[model samples]
Target: MDLEKPPAQQPPDGCLVVAIRVPVRIVMLVVVLPVRMAWDALVVAGRFLDDAVLRPVGRGLLWFGRAVFVWPFVALWRWVLVPAGRALAWLGHVLVAVPCGWLYRYVLTPIGHAIAWVGRGIAAGLAWVYARVLTPVGHGIMWLLKGLGAVLAAGGVGVAWLVRYLLVVPATWLYEWLLAPVGRALVWCVNGLVWAVRMIVTGIGTALYWTCRILFVLPALALWRWLLVPVGHALAVVGREIGAALGHAWRVAGHISRAVGRFLATLFRWIFVEPVRWAYARVLTPVGHAVRDAVLRPVGEALRAAGRATRQALASARDSARQARADFRRMLFGEPRQPRATVRREPAAADTRTLGSSTTALTKD
Candidate 1:
């Protein structure tokens, strides 16, 4: 009945060993199988995500990245890459600045000083060479100028002497000879002209005297006798007629003078007394009074009114100015116009004196 006592109940260690083996195998199978299945499922799921969603998203992301990063790459090329390259190039120059400054200070400065010294030596040498080379030339030029001046002076003197000898002496002799003959000929011509003039004057005087005697004296005597008789008779008639005409003209002139004097007296009396007196009584005095009353009186009244208005306006302006000045004083001093108590903080005499002087000047003004 006990199933042969279950092989007499195996040892606990053997039973525990058997039980551990089965459990280990079961555990391995259960854990390993499910983990493998789960791994396979995860792989499948990852493939599915990649094929369905991740691949498209990755493509889109890559496209978007290209689109977005392209401009950035261009910007980087322009801003960073180009600038970095330029900076790298300029770095060489910037790096050289300190050394260059140092070289210039320490090495180049000395070299420049040496060059200046050498230039001075060269300049001195050139000066010496120029002195050596130009000394002869200067002397030669001076000698040439001296020789030329001497030649010119001598030529001028010789020419003057030659001209005096050849031209002046000959011209003097020729002039004397020619002028002497011409003077003699001119004297002969003058004497002949004088003799001819005397002859002609004598002939004309004789002929004129004869003609005057024949023409003037005989005709005058005959004409005087012929005219004297007629003239005596005519003068007698003219004297009688003239006396009669003069008497008539004197009577007519006396009549005209009386008439003109009477007319002038009447005209003077009428114009001076009657017309002027009438006009003065009727028009002039009354017009003078009317003009004075109408025009001058009104003008005087208007002027007085304007003067009063102007005085009022000036007074108002003065009051407004006084008010504005008061307001300005209040704004500036933060007080009304009343004597303020002087607070002496340090008792500076100069400040007090200045303030007192200003206040006295304002009060006086």
Candidate 2:
């Protein structure tokens, strides 16, 4: 009846003991068994799902992930790689730039300078050759030109002298020869003319003396006697006749002068006074009135009438022209034709006949 000692009842028949001696194995078994079973079931289920559906889904997800993340990463790399590479290249260039510049200065610049120097030297050599060697040739050419100019000048001088001698000597000879003959002939003709003039003067003087003696002296002597006898009688008769003729001429001249003067006076009075009176009576007053009445009034009326008529005619003409143009246009191009009606109608009828024939043929076929 000592319950305490009752042989520590043999720990539930299948209970295990572990190292800790506290039925840990049994506790572990009891507790972990269900978890392990559940884990196993889960693992089996996961395996089945993976085989059936999850694997394919995972693969699709992997592909999707690759497409979404890896492709974009690759695309980003492709897109940015050039600039990145350029940056790297620029960095490389920056790193190498100084050396390259130094290399160019030291190596390439020397070569370029050497080539330029060589070219300059060659050009200088050519120029020197041209200046030194060809200078003598140029001098020769100048000398030749000078010699040619001298020869030409000499020839020109010679030709000028020859021309002067030929032309002037010949012309002087011809002029002297021709003028000598002309001078001699003119002198001879002048001498002859003088002789003839002297002869003519002497003959004229002698003949004049003889003619005067015969015509004037002899007649004068003869007439002197005759005149002496008849002088008294002739003087008396001439005196009487002269007196009578003077008296008659004086009377006739006086009468003619009086008549002419009277006629002129009368004509003058008639011309001036009669015309003045006639103009005053017939023309001036009546003309003033007639001008006032007929000319000014009629001109004013005619001007007004002309203005009105012009305006009316212009308006009428404008309207008539508009109407005529309209009518002409209607006749020419409107629906109702005029002179060309038959011409247009013939063609239109022919076209209609042709259309009808075509239509009839089409219907028949």
TM-score of each: 0.25, 0.22
Q: List the global CA lDDT of all models.
A: 0.78, 0.77
Candidate 1 clash figure, as a count: 0
Q: Lowest-lDDT window of 10 residues in candidate 2?
A: 13-22
Q: Which ten residues in a row have the lowest lDDT in candidate 1?
A: 10-19
lDDT for 32 (candidate 1): 50
lDDT of 1 at 113: 97
Off by over 4 Å in 1: 1-216, 226-277, 333-365
Q: Model 2: runs farther than 4 Å from truth?
A: 1-272, 275-283, 294-296, 303-311, 330-365
